[model samples]
Target: MTHFGIICPPVTGHLNPMIALGYELKQRGHSVSLLGWEQHREMVEATGIHFVPILSPRQAPQPDQKITSSRRMRLRHKLHRLKQRLQPVDHQAYTQSNGISALRIALAAYQHWSAIALRAAPAVIKAKGIDVLLVSETSYGGSTVAEYMGIPFITICVGIPRHQSSAVPPYMTSWPYQLALWARIRNRLTYAWLDILQRRILRLLNRYRRDWNLVPYTTLTDSASPLASLACLPKAFDFPVSLPHNFYFTGPYINDICRKPVTFPFDQLSDKPLIYASTGTLSNQASVYRCIAAACDGLDIQLVISLGGKGRDVALSNLPGNPLVVDYAPQIELLKRASLVITHAGLNTILESLAQGVPMVAIPGVLDQPGAAARLERSGAGKFIALKQLNAKRLRKLIQEVLQDPTYKDQARQAQAVIQQSGGVKHAAAIIEDVLDLAHISV
Candidate 1:
């Protein structure tokens, strides 16, 4: 049996897919283990995979600050504010500060997590006789372990493809697939800056690699399963562009097999068309929740809002038609009954919605969310409203349009077909076996 070690960031979106992949590999008689943060240990262990802890560097605001949903600026939010602070100074000043600052923060976080992973991993690899390593796109340290140990590794990318390409807009920017001349030039420049940031990250990575006598990597992407880059998302979500030779679009890696079913009150709802809304694990603005409640106020829609992160005691008093407010919901189950979803355009949520043929109204905030939202709009599967422009009236209108129009649902089904054909973890497991076969690595 081939022993596989999977490394990932602690976030739910990243960990969930990796957990699913581990189950699939284990089902095939391969041993699977996961290395990540301590908080996720219970969840990982619940999957019956060996769990290794990666020490997380305490950021200024703490990790929980990031998960807290409020209007007050958290530490990371302060960094964003600092980024915007440079905007009025000068173009170059804003670009340099904003780009480098964000890159440094990410590098710092990755460096801490990776350093811990690198130190703890070799021993585990040796003990387990691990044949292959599966690394999350966010876990920079996993690549270093592969480099140090000379093991075959496959990158599991769950979200927007971070690799720079002229055909696609640089990640984090909400630019659509179709672009004009100026837009194209802007896109190129975005990639250029992105490369600069990646190079900065590479420098830090190489510093750690030096201790192991491994060669320095020129491109950050090189560290990501160079032999076989695996994208857990389907090609349908990405732009029409050529990918690298080793890149494999392995489709949505939903953890359906091991997914713990969440129970929701089925008897506590009206007969009105159900609308499911979530702002994701991080940053569920109470204001947005209130807006949604007001929008659907007295309307013929029963709104189900998932206020993610730390759930406070919420009284549904004075809300429109007594909307259901829960800390979390059985999202897959909700989408099954939902006619429309209001989301932050997280990759997993978008894919889940597509799989269920549920249309969306994307409300993206920060990171790759904007790009995901743009993809939804471009594909005609959903519409996006900027956070700055969100209100009860506009949101209500969009919801009304989505419910009334059949085109959105039709398009969602088309994407669903793509998702199904791409195959889930089963296909990924097959491809991994193929990679092992090509390498002549004995099981």
Candidate 2:
């Protein structure tokens, strides 16, 4: 059986698609294993895949409480609780610094995380006997490891496509796909500026690769996967563009492969239309949650807000009306019953909403979200509102417009049908097998 090593950061969005693909591979008689944070060992192992821990000190600790009567035990418990509370703030400060912009912070975070992943990958790859490696595009280290070991690798674009193309605007912006002459020139210039900004990071990575006697990459992302890659979203969501022959959209992996079932107040539902709002697991800001909650206050609807794991400090008691506030919820299950969704324009959430035929009001926070939101609006499946302009009144108006209008739901269903036909996990498996076959023929 062919063995595959699934390498990615321990974020929920990144891990879900990889795990779904792994399940498809395993069912075809191939073996699959995941390499990620030590804290996620139990959760990953429970999925019946081999879990390889990175053992990095920077990895966040999972919440666990132990009771002990002794003074020493009590002291340790107190310290642990203190650490847990401070972690969110520390992480926020690191991600949102005054001197550095969010983009630079993301690059720095990626660089640091890749360094940790690189240190642990070689031994894991050797031990697992992985023939081909599948890496989420965001996991920069996986690509580095594959290059270092001279192994054929496949890159998975888990979010909006990040490939540099002149046909569409650059990612992480509110710009629409269709641009005038000046705008098109401006888009290319923006890309050029980004390349310049990332030159130092690219140089550092190339230098790191030289230590292992590997060729330098032109850009940080350009040389990550030289063989084949998978785009996890449906083809309909992307603007028209030419791609490499090896690059293909394998549809969204919408299966419940790697998700844990969450309990929500399902029985307490009223006849009013249900609105599910979330800013994804990582970008769940308390202010955004408060705005969404307040907007739906006194309205004839059930509003459910997922705080993600980062909103521990947000107090739910002071919320307006009887809005349901939970740390996490069963998103897919909720979407099935939801008439509308208010999201951060995260690709995962957007795809999920579309797949379930639920219209959305996207409020993109950062990263590729803004680009994805713009696409959503263009597709007629949803609309986007700027974070600065978002308020109780504006959000209420948008929600009413989307719900009262039938075009949004119709377009969402159209996207849903395309997703279904794109041949999700089954198509992805066939692509990987073809790549393997090609390798064998070359050998």
Candidate 3:
């Protein structure tokens, strides 16, 4: 049996899918362990997979103490500033400023996390005698650690696939997929700009590579595993762009059997058509929630808002609609009954909505969300509005449009058909095993 080491960001969106995949592999008789932050130990171990703490006690955030590190404090300040700047005022200016600020903040966080992982992960993997590694595409240090140890690893795209191509727009933008020459040129130029902006991250990675006596990665894609690169996105939901031969779209690694149980007030659900609204687990902005509540206030449908564990302190009673507000909702279960989903266009939520054949109106925030929303729109499954363009009146109009239109549901059902056949966690496990077998044969 292969002993697998799983590495991903500590955030819920990334961790959930990787853990689900790990759980599936363990069920198939392979041992699996997650190397992550100390705070995530309980959440990771709950899935019956072993958890390895990668950060020293000095570096890990303490539950009761405030983090006073200069880097962390600066990050918190940047986030606070970002939240303030996300107000729906000037659409064009907001988009530009937000993109730059968000990119800076993301790069800073990546550099910090990668530094810790590169320092600590090698020893843990060696100590555990891991046979194979499953690294998230977003976790910059996982593949580096595997290479330094001379082990095989597989790349898991927990979000949108980050494989670069001039034919496809960058993951951060809401640009549509167009095969025209001009469109390709625009995509290439954007990628070039991004490469320049990300020089610092590349330099940081190469510094470690040099010290480890490994070849430096000139591009981010060089870090992806040649054996296999797997994505949780369904093939049907993505743009018609060609990817590397090693890449496989294995649908979403959704293993509800291993997920943390959330206590939702199911009895409070009414007979009215359900509208599930969420900004995902990471984005718990009260302003966004307020706008959503205001838009659905007078509608006939019953609105259910999930604060994603970050909104417990939000005054639910003060929200415009008397919507059922929960810190966490049983999302997969709720989507089954939902007629419409208003979301931040997170891939997991979008895939879950499509799996249940529920249409959506997307208000994409940051990271790969805009790209996912673009694909959702291209697939004829949903409509999307830029977060900066979101307001009560506009969002309500789009919500009504999606709900009244039959085509959206029809398209969603078509996508649902593809998801049902994509083999999800099972397919992912089988692929990993196949890759492992092939690697062994080559050796």
- Tell me the TM-score of each prediction against the true structure: 0.85, 0.88, 0.89
**CA lDDT, every model vs. true structure:** 0.74, 0.75, 0.82
Of the candidates shown, which would achieve the greatest lDDT relative to the real structure? Answer: 3
Better of 2 and 3 by TM-score: 3
Worst 10 residues of 2 by lDDT: 60-69
* lDDT tens readout by residue for model 2, 38-102: 77777677668788776552342321122123533543454344334322223574323321265
* lDDT (Cα, tens digit) per residue for candidate 3, span 295-380: 99899999999988765455556889788988889889999999999998889899989988999999887778899999999989
Model 2, C-alpha of 122: deviation from truth (Å): 1.1
Query: How do these models rank on lDDT, best leading?
Result: 3, 2, 1
lDDT of 2: 0.75
Off by over 4 Å in 1: 55-108, 196-200, 281-284, 313-318
lDDT for residue 216 in candidate 3, whole number 0-100: 98
Evaluate candidate 2 by giving its C-alpha RMSD to the native, one decimal.
Answer: 8.7
Query: Which portions of model 3 miss their true places by more than 4 Å?
Result: 56-97, 281-284, 312-316, 441-443
**Candidate number of the best TM-score:** 3
Off-target runs (Cα >4 Å) in candidate 2 are 57-90, 94-100, 281-284, 441-443
lDDT per residue as tens, model 1, 287-383: 6678888888877888998876436533344666568887778888888899899998888899899999999998876567777888899889999
